[model samples]
Target: MKIRLLSGGVEVRGILLAAVVALGLSATTAAFACEGGSCVNGLAYEAFGPAPGTGSPLLAVFVHGDVSAGGPADYMYSYARQFAASRENVVAIALLRPGYYDRAGKRSDGSDNGRRDTFQSSSNRAVSGAIRELRRMYKARAVVALGHSGGAGTLGVIAGADPGLINGLVLASCPCDVPAWRASRGRGGGYASQSPVDYLSGIPRGTPIVAVTGSSDDNTHPELASNYVAKAQALGLNARLQLVGGGHGFSSGVGGAAVSALGGMAR
Candidate 1:
């Protein structure tokens, strides 16, 4: 439930669980699309920067991995903080994927679907919509997405499905191949989920992609990302894989890798 960042003398010590939190950006659930006669604004996000829409050199959005129902959805806060703190010209956002509610009572709109299988195309639509809204609000020149585990998988799918929307992508411990990942766990996918491998042709050639996975992660095997990168590189995309010597969970090493990917953009 706690996020740890301990790379290069930078230590993110605490979680922002204040009941009365006040960020410059909108604190309410911000949804940008509509489906079935209802507004599709179920995504909640926390941001670090000046008010949205003024101007920023880089806009970075973070999405957390899937967890059990009602689990704390703030594990990616460190990534948000790192992106924001890296440069003054950056606006970093920690987005609660559709249907996720943090302990601080902020819930993003959508069905979490038991936190096991929320990576449906419908969910990606919601996420893409949210990112578009944030980009417009910030008038960002560059957009980068940083995600871990399931969040990484979703972003990987998005990179191919929605090209030109994001300028850079960082995926950590992702199960990019949905069917293979599910079969590895002995679970049949009764729900719908898109595989990043299927969308490789959709990615534009210039976009930069970085996927980092733990050496000891059994949940989302490193080969999953490795295979995805191999294909992406073969297709002329700027994608590479970094194997971290750890587990599947987020750590400072993951945070540093994200910073490396994003810091280049800030410059």
Candidate 2:
């Protein structure tokens, strides 16, 4: 469960080790959310950390893919818990995509939110809005954005829109180049303009990004992840590509890679 940073220096390895230790020692968990008025954009989410006014906290938001198979919240919670454990001043959030869990811990009927753009601008906007709302709610000084599978695409949109919003990003099993993937599926109706690859040039230079995928993954294709790292680096972003042994879902390496990236943000 190690990540070989593509363009990172020797210190990256040490940072990752320290991140692992930090996460191993964390034991605090308390649910949190926006109080009083309705939540931003009516998005549903779960959060863990010290009470909002108790202390300033580093923010980490984890986004999950489709919910057809269920357990999106539980799956993301596992990673969030690990992240929360690593930093005493950190708050971890698991943002459930629209129509998955549109309210606090409540699953929806799996209906589309009446958008023609599907996973295009509409989906991206929703994710970006969630991040913005979370930041506003917590007044976090730093943010680490993480996503898996389809959620990775959403994070890409957020990064491209405003790289400064998150200090670091971790994308696992990302189908960033949507057009190419759609073409491979023998489909003609895909949003080329909304793909993550299309927005790489828009990310702020020097923004830290880590793209990870499994060596055995065919869903997003490991090459896609590598391609994202290459393109981001070409655009002058601090990016890394990690390919671990597994499939399309989150693997142990994915968590380690994210923790390492978050650790790097402090340096």
List lDDT for all candidates, in order: 0.78, 0.70
- TM-score, every prediction: 0.81, 0.76
- Residue-level lDDT tens digits of model 1 in 1-267: 244676775656445634335442344434222233112255777888666656665788888889763577987777688668757878888888877766766677667778878788998888888888788777888788888888887888888899888888888888899998998888885868788889889888888889888888888888898998998899999999988778877773665676577666564
Counted clashes in each candidate structure: 6, 3
Candidate topping TM-score = 1
Q: Which 10 consecutive positions of candidate 2 have the poorest summed lDDT?
A: 27-36
Which ten contiguous residues of candidate 1 have the minimum total lDDT?
31-40
At residue 42, candidate 1 shows an lDDT of 56
User: Candidate 1 versus the native: TM-score?
Assistant: 0.81
lDDT of 1: 0.78
